[model samples]
Target chain A: MDCYETRMEPGDRLILCSDGVTQAGLGQKRYKFGWRRSGELEFAQNIIRKSPEISAKDLAYAIAFQALSISPEKCTDDISCLVIYLRHPRVLRILTGPPYHKEHDHDFAMLASGGANDVIICGGTTASIIERELHTKVEIDLNLMKASGDLPPPGMMPGIGLTTEGILTLSKVCTVLEKKQQDKIPLAAKAIINRIMENDCIEFIVGTKVNEAHQDPNLPLELELRRNIIKRLAIILERDYRKKVTVNYY
Target chain B: MKKITLEICCGTTCYMLGTQKLLQIENIMPEEWKNCVAVSAIPCLNNCTSENICGAPFVRINGEIMSHASVESIFNRIRELLPGEGEE
Candidate 1:
């Protein structure tokens, strides 16, 4: 029973291993390379020597392979390594429905059509409006959407990030967002929601023009209005995820 | 040499239920961890409606989902995985 309390310092190297790596085969002239301290270090240095830029994951695999190759043809114990790294972020902007009046259409279209930010157009009508206003094309991707029932699948515009069904999908997204169940949501919803969560500041560009025809008479009282749903989502992003939720109404 | 990506849920339900308070963690996080653990805000982590029903205030350590997250809870977890190497 040996326990060393050495603390970790930059440039310090440490390795932990099981008997499989250090054990010697009984009654044989063979001794594992990892059986000795020098051999073990040499093994690791050789990996780094071969590829100076190898990632942690690749390095783990390289060591594991060497350990297993000590007796390649047959039995060896389980071997493993853990490597980790940090990450960074971005923002998400969703442009759904349409502007309240036709006059704001040009400005809304121009504002939402620009690049350098991830943009999502939730409603089919909104996508068309943006397409017509900007003279860009929107191609619907029928195969990629989730279980949207009557709503059409997601679409792609010339410069926009994503385009999908409006009311039906938004309602489902709100449900999933409330439920916090990522898998139950469809692909389009999943992508947007994932992006929303993955970022520090998520802005929603909501087109206030109400689409009365798409509303289902059977909808629950809460899901009936697009404004309410978008607002509720904004509140969640603000309160729950702690993201900077900006609602820009067109 | 491991970087922990701490993803906090900023979705409505979590926020409404008080997850907003968790945001302060960014300020109090040990300076050394700022480089090791990159904390980011996410819209929703889905603990509210899942079968487990862990409720609001959720986060993800790397890709592992954690329900009912808090500053103390998250700090303890991060500390375990990355105990301070003397405040770099």
Candidate 2:
């Protein structure tokens, strides 16, 4: 089992494990593995030390990966994992770079300089491009390099479907912006949207609400842009997939 | 002669388990079967919660679900369905 301790607000507790724990001691045959893990708290703690860096979600997967590495050879043993966390946080990470030109530098500098928690643009030409464009440094998730050919349209990322819920979930994770800062949104989104439109999986949705929302004076420009961008992205996603896209405003 | 059509679901669950790569069936098939088989892709079979979701890496042939939708297995199945000289 993988053990975790919550360090952030909204104190949460989590336990992760390989399928071994679930398969080991359960009376029922069907989904018994899940139920057993649900009740076994102390046993879960015995497997690993507290992790201060990994989130509850990542902790679970990390444990699962660790177990897979150590498990007996030649046996599948139903490798699995269990994650328990009181609450999950809404996280948004935006990456931008590979400047178009030395004269026309590009980066998600708008977000970085706007008081984002992390700044990841590399030093040198990459950092220079971002620095020239925006005010602050944003932490870069190096893992993004693994991303392959053109990103799928707005809601077409792997494991994300075209359903209303899926669309809403993806929208929540992505940072949106008004057309004014059109240059600020991730290039991947635009590339993906173009492909989605090409495949007829989605279409543009523009109406008084979307138009008016961007015009709202009460909301900050960033917040307003954030809100409407999601709507536009959703309309495109729904149109292409031929489905209803839903959103939850918090 | 019986023609075969293969359809793979790209649904959320399947997609997460790496169904995008499963779409290489057309390329994997032998040269001769190209004219006899038609391969297509769709998003979501709504089979997310199933335990087998992780293994699908799934194909539907003539409307029948083929389990363990691996590249090798699919190649064999396509071969079996090809129009040929006689009974096996």
Judging by lDDT against the true structure, name the best candidate. Answer: 1
Q: Report how far residue A185 has shifted in candidate 1, in Å.
A: 2.7
Q: Against the unseen true structure, what C-alpha lDDT does each candidate score?
A: 0.63, 0.42
How well is each residue in B1-88 modelled by candidate 1, as lDDT tens digits? 8688887654434543455466556777778678888776543453544333334557888788877788888887887678463364
Query: For model 2, what is the error of residue B88's alpha carbon versus the real structure, in angstroms, after optimal superposition?
Result: 4.3
Which tens-of-lDDT digit does each residue in B24-80 have in candidate 2? 556656787788887765433433333344445456888888766777777777767
Please give, for residues A1-250, the per-residue lDDT of candidate 2 as tens digits: 8876556444456465555644443434443444354444533454434643345556666656544444444335666666655543322222222333334343233433433222222112223334346533222222231242222112222221121112222343333322323443343344433333234222222111121222333322223343455566566546544534444331
Q: Which stretches of candidate 2 lie over 4 Å from their true place?
A: A1-250, B85-88
- DockQ for each numbered candidate: 0.01, 0.01
